[model samples]
Target: MTTSLTIAVKRIHDAAAASDGARFLVDRLWPRGVSREKAALAAWLKPLSPSDALRKRYHGETADSDEAWDAFRLDYFEELDAGGEEAKAALFTLDAAAKVGPVTLLYAAKSAERNNALALREWLERRTR
Candidate 1:
């Protein structure tokens, strides 16, 4: 990976004002009320998202609980590690985009700080270093 690689996370509902680099939807399920045209996504990398069971277990309701969130974060990372080919494919896609410039990961979670995109960004950064 290039030292210049940059990763950013943003909500899907947010307006996209820039065309500086790749934009990908990192959620396993397509965001509600967002059309494909409006999304303007380069890719919808479901493989990069948390599994259904994990997502359900750590839904938006868990955000307020630090302990739950911590446990979710740990479990999520484990899933990413054990994700095998799926995780590898997503990482490859991210790496390819990052080589050129910034790669923005879009998610639908209401809590910006408690989403998989943030976790994925951290995991990717660690791998890049």
Candidate 2:
């Protein structure tokens, strides 16, 4: 397996041409306004997403506030660290995929920087090092 992995984040609704590498959906919920054919997903790894309670508390109205966002990131990081078996499995699968090529984490979040996919990517990069 590759010691380092090349990971990228993309919106599920982005142009199909932007699709690259082994595509995986890291969102717990399917994106609205996007068809399955358009998604062209290889897998939907909901186990990698934040817990339902965490997600609900931080998203929608709360997700718009910087303070909430910061808190969300902090809480989400804790969740990732304590994410246990499912998170480990997701990371393992991602690492394995990267051995062959790049791995693109597909998410529906409007904020590319604040989304779970970014957190997951950051977490994986840190672990691989």
Candidate 3:
């Protein structure tokens, strides 16, 4: 399977429109002001978001690094390793079906540079590679 990650809002809409496409919102909290219908998401994979403690610790912090990921793996097992695995599997099923376009992973965060989406995208890309 081939997949890529992007952060543009318009790109997300475009990806979701393509054939074999699915959009998963990987955030614990729903983005403010966006309705479910308006979001047009196939799934809200909140279980894939970082834990509250981790979010508080890592958000806006540049100190978060590879070691942070290791710490997260231990603490994030229940949410990510277990629940997220299932969500990711489902997304991959969508990917397999989507032979034409990219599967967009969306997020509702103000910080575009440092958010769960980037981390999750990094993790998934590394694994897929």
What TM-score goes with each of the models? Answer: 0.91, 0.85, 0.61
lDDT of 2 by residue, 5-70 (tens): 678899888965543888899999989999988888767888888788988888755676789877
Error of 1 at 52 (Å): 0.4
Residue pairs with backbone atoms closer than 3 Å in model 1 (clashes): none
Worst 10 residues of 1 by lDDT: 14-23
Which digits, one per residue and each the tens of the lDDT, describe model 1 over residues 2-95? 6567888999998875753688998999889999988888788999898999898887455769888888878888988888887788778888
Whole-model lDDT values for every prediction: 0.83, 0.80, 0.59
The candidate that achieves the highest TM-score relative to the unseen native structure: 1
List the candidates ranked by TM-score, beginning with the highest. Answer: 1, 2, 3
For every candidate, C-alpha RMSD to the true structure in Å: 1.6, 2.2, 5.1
Q: What overall lDDT, based on C-alpha atoms, would model 1 receive against the true structure?
A: 0.83
Residue 69 CA error for candidate 2 (Å)?
Answer: 2.2
lDDT of 3 at 7: 25
